[model samples]
Target: MNQLDIDKMVLRLNVGYNGFKFKESDLKDGELKDWAKKNNLLKSDDKQKD
Candidate 1:
């Protein structure tokens, strides 16, 4: 998909999540896990797996 379409999907997802708003870079750079860890968004088991 195009960037605009990806942006729109990210926007929609962020709207549903209340506090977390993910940037395209987060997904693109594979930093989502780190971001989630910093934000305390990951579960204890998931964190351990990482």
Candidate 2:
């Protein structure tokens, strides 16, 4: 999947499980990427290419 798709899934998980209130716009930055990395949802070298 792409970055946006990954972010959406992560957002849903967070909102559903952690009671977060983030919107789709919030995922435009690297917040979900960092969270996913910290939670091992992403690999250390999973940086996306432009």
Candidate 3:
């Protein structure tokens, strides 16, 4: 079996966070909505910054 790095995957999903830094916790979400909230993606109307 192969296990993907969910953290890297989640970080890459964020258009603002693409190629940007992210906290390991971002990958801990069981749902995208929850993850988005934790990473401030829901409230972030603009591109994110490092």
On a 0 to 100 scale, what is the lDDT of residue 15 in model 2?
Answer: 55
TM-score of each: 0.34, 0.42, 0.29
lDDT of 1 by residue, 1-50 (tens): 88655655565566457745544334443354455446554344332442
Q: List the residue pairs that clash in candidate 3.
A: none
Pick out the ten consecutive residues of candidate 3 with the lowest summed lDDT: 1-10
In terms of lDDT, which candidate is stronger, 2 or 3?
Answer: 2
Alpha-carbon lDDT, every model: 0.49, 0.54, 0.49
- The lDDT, on a scale of 0 to 1, for candidate 3 is 0.49
What is candidate 3's lDDT per residue for 9-48, written digit by digit as tens? 5554764756454343534546654655565544333565
Give the Cα-based TM-score of candidate 3 against the true structure.
0.29
lDDT top scorer: 2
lDDT of 2 by residue, 1-50 (tens): 89777766866686568866543233444766566545544323334431
The reply for model 2, stretches above 4 Å from the true place, is: 23-50
Q: How far is candidate 3 from the true structure (C-alpha RMSD, Å)?
A: 7.9
Global CA lDDT computed for model 2: 0.54
- Which candidate leads in TM-score? 2
Determine the backbone clash count of candidate 3: 0
In Å, residue 30's CA in model 3 sits off its true spot by 7.1
